[model samples]
Target: MTVTDTHTHLYSDAFDDDRKVMIERAIAANVTRFFIPAIDSSYTKAMLQLEADFPNHVHLMTGLHPTSVKENYMEELRHVEELLSKRKFVAIGEIGIDLYWDKNTLEIQQEAFSHQIRLAKQYRLPIVNHCREAFDEIFVVLETEKSDDLFGIFHCFTGDIEQAKRAISFNMKLGIGGVVTFKNGGIDKFLNQIDLEHVVLETDSPYLAPVPYRGKRNESAYIIKVLEKLSELYGLSQEVIAAITTENSKAIFKV
Candidate 1:
């Protein structure tokens, strides 16, 4: 059973002490594919280095994270443009409105999100979105930008059935992670309702680790706990869930 983590920050600082060990642990558990989301230009080198180290496992994405947007955002967007022009990445990602961090920059966040979506369309790559506490805002953008040319995963998705349908309408697969195991994650109530093919597995490592490891640092290996939860939710075996979600990941990332 080959499992895929559609969103993981294997290059994050939290893994500095034992990144290799953590990765090997995940690999041993059959977590074979790793999609790394880009935050900004500063981490580009680290991302590239990670891919060089694990060329077969690590697939890179390029985009400016919404929370990373600020006054110098145009410069950052330029950097994104330059990078896209130069090399290839699996997707344009982790990009969307993050009103939770700073509502003040909402306008710029929207601008950056739209810009990257256009970039993704231009490059004919899928997008990995990072919507947080801004569903309406994201929907507004998607409503206007919806097109056959636009499609991707809504990374770390946490929303209702209606919202899930809305995202799918815009050509997005819901990225399920640790949150689904949470008591109040909400998606659990309606997840089984959505087709498994519309969902993708992710750990968002160094972030939303599944329960049993909740409130603690998350590693890619911990994704098994999430796989178990999903197995239960979908009435499928862990191996089946792994295969289905990994197939879903391949459909979106094309990798």
Candidate 2:
């Protein structure tokens, strides 16, 4: 029963103290795969070091996160493009619109998101989207960039069934995470309507910890809580959820 943590930030400063222990704990819990998303040029070195540290277990993606989009967004995008030209990354991702934090940068966020999506298609790499409070904005860009080569996971997806369907139509898999385990998370309300095939498990470490660890810093090891919730909601065994979702992840990352 191997589980995949499709979204996690091993490079996060939150893990500065005991990152190795956190990963070891996840390994012991049978959550072997760790997909790391890039936030911006700032974290590139740390992210690369993480991949080097856990060559077999960690997969990396490069992009400018929406929240990181600032006035100098183009320079950041250039850094991302430079990385894409040099190294091999599983996807071009953790990219999308984020209106929750600041609405002022909405335009720049959209530009960066759309530009990254185009880069993903150009490189023939899957994307890892990070959208928050900006589904409408995201959909608009996705609608324009909709193409066979443009497909990836909607990382940390917490939208409704309609949004889930819309994401899939644009060639994205719904990334289910700790929120699915929360009693009032709301995503569980409509998750069953979507097939497990379109679903992929994640932890989004240092954020959105599952039930037992809610309100605390999340970690990849806590993906078990998510698996448990999926088991209960779908009436399937944890082993089954792990198997199917891990397979779906493999299909996306091609790892």
Candidate 1's TM-score: 0.99
Worst 10 residues of 2 by lDDT: 181-190
What tens-digit string does per-residue lDDT give for candidate 2 at 133-239? 99999999999999889999999999888989999999899999999988888999989878999999999999999988899999999999999989988899999
lDDT tens per residue, model 1, 1-255 = 999999999999999999889898999999989999999999999999999999989999999999999999999999999999999989998899998989999999999999999999989999999999999999999888899999999989888899999999898999999999999889999899999989999999999878988999999888899899989988999999999999998888888
RMSD of each: 0.7, 0.8
Clashing pairs in 1: none
lDDT of 2: 0.93
Clash totals, every prediction: 0, 0
Model 1, runs deviating above 4 Å: none
Candidate 1 displacement at residue 233 in angstroms: 0.9
Quote each prediction's TM-score: 0.99, 0.98
